[model samples]
Target chain A: MNQSMVKVFDIQKDDFISAGEASSSVKKILKQLGVSPEVIKRAVISMYEAEMNAVIHGGGGKGYAEFFKEHIEIIIEDNGPGIENIELAMQEGYSTAPGNIREMGFGAGMGLPNIKKHSDQLEIKSEVGKGTTLKITINF
Target chain B: MEEFINSVTLDKDKCKGCTNCIKTCPTEAIRVRNGKAYIIKERCIDCGECIRVCPHHAKKAVADKLEMIGNYQKAIALPAPSFYGQFPSEYSRKKLLIALKNIGFDGVFEVAAGAELVSAETEKRLQTENFKKPMISSACPAVVRLIQMRFPGLIDNILKLESPMQISAVMARKLFSEKFGISENELGIFFISPCAAKVTAVKSPIGIKKSAVNGVIPISEIYGLVHESLKNTEDDNQTNIFSSDIGVGWAGSGGESNALSSGKTLAVDGIQNIIKVFEQIENDKIENVVFIEALSCPEGCLGGPLAVENRYVAKSRLKQHMEEAKSEKAQIKPVLSKAITWSEPIFPSSVLKLDDDVMIALGKIEQIEKIEKDLPGLDCGACGAPNCKALAEDIVRGIAKETDCVFKLRERVRQLASEMIELESELPHTMNRTEKNEN
Candidate 1:
């Protein structure tokens, strides 16, 4: 399929105030693009979950969204501490977030699971001492 | 194609081309074009937020006049529950019902009675049917239309029940005709509405083929006449009683949900707040909520633009009136009637389409985004549109130009200045010498 547009946003770590801003912008763009509501909803949900994961876990991250004729691809990469146990991190309700972050009503550990549930294709890559990268694709 | 008729209209003479209405419009249906606020008919839900916020009183709710009732041999007034809240608590409900008779109505039927019936019917449906979790209320026509225009995916969640106004009109016309030995055509059933949306519902029903109500009279228009009649009545002999406290409570927010003694219910008032709840619903975040009563007007019907009293005051009066009711139980029982249910499927109004083709729409979106980047993002509405984003959309649609943006125009002027200087510097040596000599 032909690539229509590519949008990128640099997300700041622990910036709760602007955490969902990038995802919301992508959703607005998709809506204006006349993507089906169902597709937009799934893409928005997956993008939002991944964005939040980057903000809460990965130190600071950058989000990139590519729109194509048949699908939308979202890639989020962060320089924060990488996950040691990918299997446990993907489990629902399993969180490594500190108590302070948990007190803020997030970190219920459903982020990666929700992203996987909403996305047609989800890929996660991480290094112990390096950063984590997540790629989510939602097909129209 | 049938011409679309909207109950809310802009009075050009009264309009100051202010952005107040456009900003307050939940659906973004109003646009200030050519120094006049114009309502886009297809996009409008007739929520009356524009009418409520318009400083110049330019927005008006158009409904049938009192004189229209004179055409029929007999007329019955189907007074909405909000109609009672217009008066003080000191006035008896009976006196108010009698006032309708004094105002030339041959008979009076309480819409609250229909509310009670609808409430009971909805409860039964909730229990019997294995339908979707959160069954949305179809009472507010504006909310229904909002779902159609914006939340089309949640269309199946809306309950297929006729509004109390429609059911009352149907029952009122039937009973009035039978009692007076007159044909149904000779008897007019008029709804005393609290909002402009109800007027539109009567004129152009959403799911139904035809509206049972012959006309709609806004509460504000007849408040003075009703007050006069209430003062003139010396005896209570002509008073007729109808509707219980449960029925009367339907005037305020959460009234319908309160009446439904079923599963968990969520009642949200105000267009913006309702939209937020609808978003949550659309996201599947709310799973246990059995029913949702969403009202476009703040504090429900009491806060309708056409309502005479303050919303809080009206709510208090309505509560007091409900407390004073003689019967705690519903006076009218629910009946199994076909007229109380929707006759046809409610289709979504796809007003959000940017273009017919996906590729073309995506192209337009790219153009809009490019235009948006050049805008100031102030959302000042100075460009005769709602905001910078809307201006960008208008530009993409060919309704506006890039130079139409004030900031963009300033930028152009600055660029032009730099370009002129560059052109001056690039001039040929002879031409430069001649220009220097002229200077």
Candidate 2:
């Protein structure tokens, strides 16, 4: 048996119906790993928030989860226009999601900050007009 | 250790092994092998979805026979409120209760009365108890088991309280033993449940070491006796009925949520719908909700698989009856708060895990992924597994063979036939078709 497991999910752009698929799969794997409920909840919250970020703002992307003995790590990379101001984007209620997405009950500007809140450690790398890479780690 | 107890059973003689029940089960607990379908005891939640879907009427719910009541010196019937919806609206709740007394029971207890106590207790807890947000209701035993199996993380969110049935059973024994001058054990406490889950809950309870309930009888099973006994009751001579009772409303969907004053409360019913909500709650997508009432049966208890009436008809009937009774105030009183609280807490079930060791489970997960990729992905259920993924897991678990899948079996047969043809072509020149053609 390997000490760790890796799973990947491909997020389609604006696929609201399947928005939670990545987080859900990760949650199931965590449950199978006998991860504590609190840890699973935190990981799921951050995972969903980050996944939604890719869907709504990043124009779909790829998310990866690596389950380890001590902690679980999630990495999401998107090709959408990246954030020019990382500091401002980290603030609560600061979202660049379109008006249409906000009207649909999403893009409340809580995505990035909420993910940062639930994750034990969060790091984001972005370049204007290129893409964004987000990494989140939730301790078991 | 808690004994494995399940009320749902299969009548082998009637089962056609047609793979019908396996597909409808929310837990995917049923499997066909050797031309017979059997439920995996640990995975079954007794939701009775199989019983509702079996075309051959092979699935049956095991409940105590009415004749079992005669075994005790005195027996008190605790009828679920859904039972009231089974009778005509003309018959007042009191009249229906008295009819149970006529059916050889020494006394009758209304589960709704106990429900009122639970409602009061929940309101108090909502204000005082420090709990995770979106406390899920435990009124439905099927939902309790569902959380235990599939949503193990949410076990802490379950409201820590005895159900109306258990509370009514405890109260019934106290009230009846004092009235009959008998010991509690001497008095049989039987719950008239609308579903099979309650029967299992009594036999193997969670959040309690043992259930106060002595036995459970389904409403569908007891309806005949109560109906026959109803002719002897005089409805006009009965005491005043409270049509406006908050507890009585617990029979249908949203009843539990409606009875409380909790802010941002939500009620969800039906097995699949509740499963989805549970996933969302786990993901924290459903935030700001203080409580959630999830019922496994559609339309709540009124739509239980063991229920006698159509849920739609029963829903209307229940509404009209409650409306008529609304003219009266309140006769049911809340019991002591401590009396209705759960004796223990529920623990998450690990039955759904691929293995006990995380490393081993991870290895199995990898294998399952590889196998699933190769599977036909048709989810045809011809392999006796619920889906392609399930069959892959079963194969990894060593409980099933890969050839169990018809597609895989066909591929293997085709490969073997090609190999045989090639072997024949390689036969000695004297025996080979190619040698004959050259000659």
Candidate 3:
């Protein structure tokens, strides 16, 4: 049976007040679907890291979540300066965020690494001059 | 399934179907359905937030009556530590104990003594157990229920010890029965509760199959009687219970953490704040803490809805009482029994589930999301739900309709108007054809 539900959210750059809104909505949907707490927690942490990256690194972005029978996939696409090197970005404590962002206690350089650690699978596609898209999948 | 009994009840006669209670409930256990606020038994934690917020006095905590003491040959009053903070500082601890006797209890047992024992037991467990850090206190029944419903991951962190109320009831029953040579059935152990959650705890205990206390009586119900008895009597015979000031401090916030020696602890009161802290803990944000004392009520048990005194006043009075009684210490040592420890694993209540089946719940979520898109998202609470999302859920559940929202109704009216205009234009063409045929 093809049982799937999809929801999309538009996230704006530097929108500090609503930075976590998308992740919260995703968590709420997962909870309503009666997902286990462990799965929800993993999904939340992965999605939040991706959401923050979209807002902080990318100028503005769109967050999409597709809930399926076996797994949930989250896609974050952003129109900002793309990553020059994916391998370097994935390293822990490696961040290009400005000092101001670091002072806000957010850009500790663990976003991508933490996301990879929590999600079952992570995919990163980016063109240096174009934009970046992160696809995260977490199994139920 | 056994019928679920909740201590918080609604007075239908006084209910105006207001959304205040629904909004205030942390668990979203209350819903305005059929023009009345209904409590979902599985979702309700019996925190009594609705009872405190309702303006019409519709919400009430159902507890045992004072007259029920007549049912037993010997009645023991197991007063919660918070109960001591309800009265004025002029009333001595001996006077309070005597007043309880005058009010119909054969003997008085201080729950603080049990709190002292539990504190000592918890200290020992912290040193011996190799479990998770930041162990949670299970003294507040409301907090335990909240964890069961929302924070199931932290269930293992909750201390498996019985609450001070239960321990006090057991001690009281044993001491009273032995003194009078009466059977357990003939003696009643009643807890003087500071909140509705305690009443529910006594009725249907968590972790344990049954409660040690026979019944629970709200502090508000017996406050007036205790005061009257205090005024009528003279301080001739003085009786002192076996509870130190440290144990009595458990009545207010931070008391449990303070009672424990040499550990990094965090104490949080109020349901919303506790939820935030729990979320942080789940995210691995909080660390280096040995214990966490989370209370559902603001300022701890003193802020319970069933209490007679204001929370701030009670807290100050309790502080003063603690300061004055610092020299006195508990003379009795309680023996901790193995039966009081929880042996079974705690399970999640899963009250947040939309449906029992995952597929059905997923389908419902799609419908709710579709409905939510059309909603104005104003969260005005005009539709009798706490928010637009809740209204969308209610709509999908067939309890509400799209037209219930004013914005949706306006959109429907606009569509009908456009359809009427199209029919009106067609009417002119039909009239011309009829005129030509007649000619």
Best candidate, lDDT? 2
lDDT of each: 0.84, 0.86, 0.85
Compute the interface RMSD for candidate 3. Answer: 2.3
Tens-digit lDDT string for candidate 2 (B1-439): 4678899999999999988899989988988999899899988999988988899999999988888898999987888888888988887778888887778787777788778778877887788658766788899999999998888878888998898888878877886798789888999998888989999989988888789898888888878988998888876443333225576889999888888986689999999999999998888778678889998889999999889999989988888767765666655343334446677877877777787777787888899889999999999988998899989988998999899999999999999999999987576755667657877
Model 1 alpha-carbon drift over 4 Å, by segment: A10-17, A97-105, B234-240, B326-339, B410-439
2 or 3: which has the higher lDDT? 2
Q: What share of the true interface contacts does each candidate keep?
A: 0.37, 0.72, 0.63
Quote the lDDT for B435 in model 3.
73
As for candidate 2, its clashing pairs are B243-B325
Q: What's the distance in Å from true for residue B425, model 2?
A: 3.7
**Once superposed on the true structure, which residue ranges of model 2 sit more than 4 Å away at CA?**
A1-3, B236-244, B329-339, B426-439
* Residue-level lDDT tens digits of model 3 in B284-322: 557578899999999999999889999999998888778
Q: Which rank order by lDDT, best down to worst?
A: 2, 3, 1
lDDT (Cα, tens digit) per residue for candidate 1, span B136-212: 99999999999887877678888888888888787777777988999999998989888899989988888888998
Worst 10 residues of 1 chain B by lDDT: B330-339
Error of 1 at B301 (Å): 0.8
Instruction: Tell me what TM-score chain A of model 3 achieves.
Output: 0.97
TM-score pick, better of 1 and 3: 1
